[model samples]
Target: MRNNAPSKHVRIVLADDHDLVRSGIKALLSMIEGVEVIAEARDGNELIALVDDLDPDIVMTDISMPGMDGIAAIAEIHARKPGTRMLVLSMYDTVDFVKRAVASGACGYLMKDAPPFELEQAVRSVMATGSYFSPAIAQRLLQPSEPTVDDELTNRQVEILKLIAQGRASKEIAYQLGLSPKTVDVHRARIMERLRLNDIASLTLYAVRKGLIKP
Candidate 1:
């Protein structure tokens, strides 16, 4: 248990598109001592703006949002405020989503259905050690990396391919992954060539068939 210093409370900003979900999470967070929910955001854009204005110590956010999406916002926030830690609270349990959140610089990831005790534990763990993950996620991370697509595509390429299949432009992918547009383009070209895909449609189809994205 982390005993926060008397003068320093853990300030947090909560972000989730659903009002009820955000309210429930806020209520739960309010139960923890030495923690404060300074503000709330309904979407990733709003979360980004709030973070810019409030500069909270931690950002607790859901992965999916209507505009900008949580992963993109996390990446952007990491770029702008490297010191502000990101903690993800989401229902998405897939390893892909977990990997993406971590790659975007989130220090913690908790399942929404996790026990209430884990909430405060996660907050304290993040503040103390700079990281926490749901037990299931941690286990998955420890297990051997699951084979994705084909053996030819590197992990980074597979990540970029997932974004591209989701209709993200190269510039957006670059921003999300902290790569230059030229680098993203080069990767995209390589992916296309390696997969024998000539167009975005074919690539998207390939991604779907390979379980990279839902149809």
Candidate 2:
């Protein structure tokens, strides 16, 4: 909803390597109600530092940033501040890139070429519902596929796995799920054992393959 109230508006820090891209997105967002681009970063490293400092409601970033990739930055930011939402705004729309971005804790993914209205809608959707995927990306996730490790996971394990894939630390997951940190760790261990996932990257890939995330 468009609103004059500061609390109702979404505050965002945008990140992209190209100065022109950042400026163009900032301008587009400026025209939308209830959306404000509060700061900008030219690379993922700078974006991470800015996010830590600014603590905006959302971080909108390009995937192919310099100094550090956007996916890594998203994971880092999510680990540090799970409350801040992440959106990937990039030219790349491939399934692999989309999967990695969402696996790393991004709440939304939009191609840079999306209509201005779609961008606005994505920002609002993610802010309101905790996640959003472009229609194209969503369709890819719905395609039929062979059963995988996910089928072996219990509902609670799948829930924890998604959060883990989204880069929330065990303690943060514990708080969100109303479980102790130790319990979260136990679940995580069991998940990894069941899925034969040795690390976070493996778990993230599993999440992507299972269609639990964007890819």
Candidate 3:
């Protein structure tokens, strides 16, 4: 353990649901003398509470957790505690996931399977400066997957979104799509649910954002 503290210790708040995972990280980080685990949270809500209550210097988080997911957690944490540095440790090593994590304001991204030494290095790097990307994340950044335009939405969802954008009434959409109005409403609700949109206006905005409709 290195005496890396600057008078006041650098505290970390860890958020993960699984007891084993959180325990593992706490154990590992506990070995580093200068770093302190000031708070532990089992979910995003608790994580936010820890941020407000403890105000730890670093937020070390898992990308997946119960209640609010890690991506949302990181976004929310950064929004609330703008100065806290987020170090993301996840099992997912995909380029898309890493990009999304960093875009959500994570300062460090490391896969759980990376060597313990690398994890320690990443933590120190992020704590000392701005950010850290594990070796795998760095490689993925250089060799990123091509930008994909493929629709992740279901066929029914796309149909609903397009019909809504085309200024079609629910009944009209139902008739054209050969679905009951009830089913169309269901589809509409699901479309909003899937896209995280609010109302018809927002749906239209999403359609324009995705180039499914002209602005």
Off by over 4 Å in 2: 1-7, 144-215
Tens-digit per-residue lDDT, 8-102, candidate 1: 59999999988999999999888888889999998889999999999999999997776566887899999999999999998867666677788
Task: Report the C-alpha lDDT of model 2 over 105-178, residue by residue, as the tens digit.
Answer: 88888888888878778877877798889898787667754444335777689778878988899899999899
Superposed Cα deviation of residue 31, candidate 1 (Å): 0.6
Clashes of each: 0, 0, 0
Better of 1 and 2 by TM-score: 1
lDDT of 1 at 182: 96
| TM accuracy, model 2 | 0.64
> Model 2 residue 106 lDDT?
88
Leading candidate by lDDT: 1
RMSD of 1: 5.7
- Per-model TM values vs. the true structure: 0.70, 0.64, 0.68
lDDT value for candidate 2?
0.81
